[model samples]
Target: MSTTGAAPGLSKAFYAIIAGVGGGTGRAVALRFARTYPVALLARGEASYADVVAEITRNGGEAVGVRADVSDEKSLAAALEVVKGKFQGKGLAVGVFNVSSPVSIKPFLETKLKDLDQSLAANARGLYNFAHATLPSLVESVSANPPYPPTLLVTGATAALRGSAGFGVFAAGKFAVRALSQSLAREFGPQGVHVAHVVVDGVIEGPRTKGYIVEGVEDGKLNPAAIAESYWHLHTQHRSAFTHELDLRPYAEKF
Candidate 1:
């Protein structure tokens, strides 16, 4: 949280990239990491990241926003090329996957195959494309001898742990994301890259959830800034003690 400058001992040639920049956690995370490294914000549209990029620049930090759809391999690859050009010799120090698919809450019988496909494309296939594109750079970064390990932090949801009655479609994709995260952690840990999955278990305080009521509980919704701080912590962890998974929720929320 210190605003002094980038983290101590960090190389100027290392940078961070966050996929899915928006008004909520994505924007918050981008700002948090920007404190320590030049950052690249990726989203499907410029509107999703424009303001966040401006904010970082305003604060004397380096940042760039790119429009890229993680679910589409070609789109994501092209975006990385832009990032490479912008950062030039910088190595990827951190990669955050915060993309989510639109949810269709309905009974299983009423659910359409298209809905399932959409979720899978954004959650599972999206991560697939993202990891393939970033992991090689992450692996290569190990030789850079960064102060912390190269890291990949994934954003998951409550649906990843349980398939609620109306959340079958969402759960199916989140579950795949979790499984993939675990596999990547195991495979990449020995190679000196940190891969972790984070389960965000409560409604986040954001533009979209402003009208939702959590009766009798003041500040019941999760704070996106707080979540971003946790991500910063994860990225700075020592490689000797890597955390493969972390779950976060508000204090008043039920388990």
Candidate 2:
């Protein structure tokens, strides 16, 4: 998205910029990419970034931790710079994971406009800025690798589409995120950039999800790692059959 700084091995391997890297989904995605490509992990907290980088590095994956708050445009812009810097600052990179976490766990009626605004900032505005920041890197992609343009994976929830009485605002924000992804898919897909949304049909089970859900992980609950695999599939799938949206839930999850 911003000026790519020079870094070795950074530009050659696939470049993945993951926002909210401190969260469960960011961690999973970072680990998934670290296996084969260099990854930049973005989050508001520096400690989480350190932990994620250490985890990935310990596991033998290349990763760098960046401190950035998606809610702030300037912060997000810097994170994109980190991506380019990894490649020795010359070439473009592929992939962006815009996984935002809900700021609070409140019922629909009890939810405040401020909370909804926060979600929009993190989920929608954040996506916009990140996409904008990475556009240059995506556009300058090398033909040899034929990298995907800003392949963005937006995390969505069942309530985003189904809608619950107390989830109107959250659902509204997610709905907007879904729409943005679709718009980008149509506008950017033909250009070699892929945009997608994942409707996590049921609850996501992890430490980040513990206090946010009514029930904890069940026997048949979806695994975060497996969900990461889905992203991998979408990332590598031939541009022809690119799935713009996917629904993933456990077998026990109701349609």
Candidate 3:
């Protein structure tokens, strides 16, 4: 364990930071990262991450929860500063942007400007701010030769690829996010940052989706823990063969 930024005693242990944490995927990712490094979980409300943080800390892992709105740059910046202060000299080993844009499931003709604006803010603008804030540290981390590549993982959905009916606003935002991820991968990969976009194409198995019935398959939803394992794999991948984009879904999921 490291004494926070202010102290002369630096632990030499880097930290993993995650944005848009919640009870499902966010909690799983935080726990996965906590196994190796101090973890910072960021969400809009303490309720979203407090329990996860406590569980990590209780298990002898260093964890911190910060209330942050990814869509708001100032708030996101403040939360990141907290992360830096907590892990001070240790470089950032990984940064994950798991924010899902609010979906407007309405016909294109019925979609409003505000819905599109909200989606763009949460998906595109939020990622823009997050990358700007984290990349410098990630690049600097390259010199330290951390255990794995300094990675930035973005969470995407099927909307990132096809603009299906009734999902125009969501698709637009996800497409923009995918564009950002592709561009960032090119710009930063040579600089030692592993930027990858993960498209989760099916419904996730979580408390929120207990009632959602999937046709023929039993327990066919994607497990958040399994998704976390994939992310860890991405972080550990060799620089020689970096993955720019990856997609995951249940075995029963349709293309």
Which model scores highest in lDDT? 1
Q: TM-score for each prediction?
A: 0.96, 0.85, 0.94
Q: Alpha-carbon error at 247 in model 3, in Å? A: 0.3
| Models sorted by TM-score, best on top | 1, 3, 2
TM-score of 3: 0.94
Worst-scoring 10-residue span by lDDT in model 3: 1-10
Error in Å for residue 36 of model 1: 0.7
Q: Model 3, 22-59: lDDT tens per residue?
A: 87788899988888888889999999999999999888
Estimate every model's Cα lDDT from 0 to 1: 0.91, 0.69, 0.88
Q: Which of 1 and 3 is the better model by lDDT?
A: 1
Question: Which digits, one per residue and each the tens of the lDDT, describe model 2 over residues 180-218?
Answer: 878888887787766788888766667855655333434
TM-score of structure candidate 1: 0.96
lDDT value, residue 235 of candidate 1: 84
- Residue 152 of model 3 has an lDDT of 99
Q: What are the candidates' C-alpha RMSDs?
A: 2.6, 5.2, 4.8
Q: Best to worst by lDDT, what's the order?
A: 1, 3, 2
